[model samples]
Target: MTEGRKLRPEERILWGKVAKSTRALRARQDEVAEYEAEITAMLAAEEAALARPAPPQDVVSPPGNQLRAPRPAPSHQPLEKPVHRKLAKGRLSIEARIDLHGLFQDEAHDLLLDFLFRAHERGMRHVLVITGKGSSMGSEGVLRRTVPLWFSKPEFRFLISSYEWAARHHGGEGALYVRLSRPRRSL
Candidate 1:
């Protein structure tokens, strides 16, 4: 037959090869789709595993074999005794003051610690700590109220033997009367 009319034996063999290739391609596509579904299922399972909540349990335990019973907390006890220091009957004549207006918290802390240490070393018994009464801005000043808090800290607590508000004759409310510990020789 002519080119378009009918396929010869050789042409029929070529058509059969083409048909086989198409069937193979369809089979490969089906296999690919099945593999994709399996991968998606595995991913979903992994995500579900991740979303599972951790078991609720206590991380902390009581000391040794002692079982801790739940009980009301004890009232906070105020430390009445002086920390690591003792005051003398006599007072030193030395008085040093610092104006803590523009000082940052850390800088002010360091400066105050250094001042107290040096004063104690120099045998200073009575000290005037001048924290500018407070700010007119209503923010309770810079170092005004915080200095007292620092004095209560364990580290700085020992440095100061005893302290009270300064007399009205002195800077009064703006300053504190810090009575540092006397040197061993002075004692």
Candidate 2:
């Protein structure tokens, strides 16, 4: 192989002519424009989704086409798998955390409810509730059991969308990741 050297004046002139005679095989792609296009497509998809009537979430009776009065939505729902995975991988963020390690069940319940209310008011959606695993005896803690039960109540249902046990790094079975529902808009 020969070492590369600067082109002589005649070679440069010939190279320029050759370059001028050729054209790009394809137009240059603009990264910024591609990103903008992607965003536009996403927005269109979201709008289309909003326009479609969603399938029923709660089960209906009689297993027939007979339509009953639309019931209120179910209060409790299982945590979403994708969000749970994000929490497990540390990709998701918790807006706040509360520790109920030494507090009694009633106090913990009150605190949890208050914390959720304030967090919702501040527009925080995700939160961590640390209910320490009861003891070395391998039984569940009082708060851990009752905290989830509290979510079943009608009042708590208005506040929480779902709750699930946290990932290992998030205190594993000792803690919960709570997703708060946005307050209903006045229609």
Q: In order, what lDDT does every prediction score? A: 0.62, 0.78
Q: Candidate 2 residues 1-187, lDDT tens each?
A: 9857766656755776787676544454566567779977975875566456568686567766777767664556678999999978878888899998767778888888899899888888899999987653333566776687677666677888888999988998899999988877778
lDDT of 1 by residue, 1-187 (tens): 5535545646655765676565336759889788879977975875565456445554466578666554432222322234212212223343666666556789889988999989888887667777766534334555766687677665676677666655555556666667676765644
Off by over 4 Å in 1: 1-94, 184-187
Residue 141 miss distance in model 2 (angstroms): 1.0
- The worst-scoring run of ten residues by lDDT in candidate 2 lies at 133-142
Rate residue 67 of model 2 by lDDT: 75
Which candidate gets the maximum TM-score versus the true structure?
2
Q: What TM-score do all the candidates reach, one by one?
A: 0.46, 0.59
Clashes of 2: 0
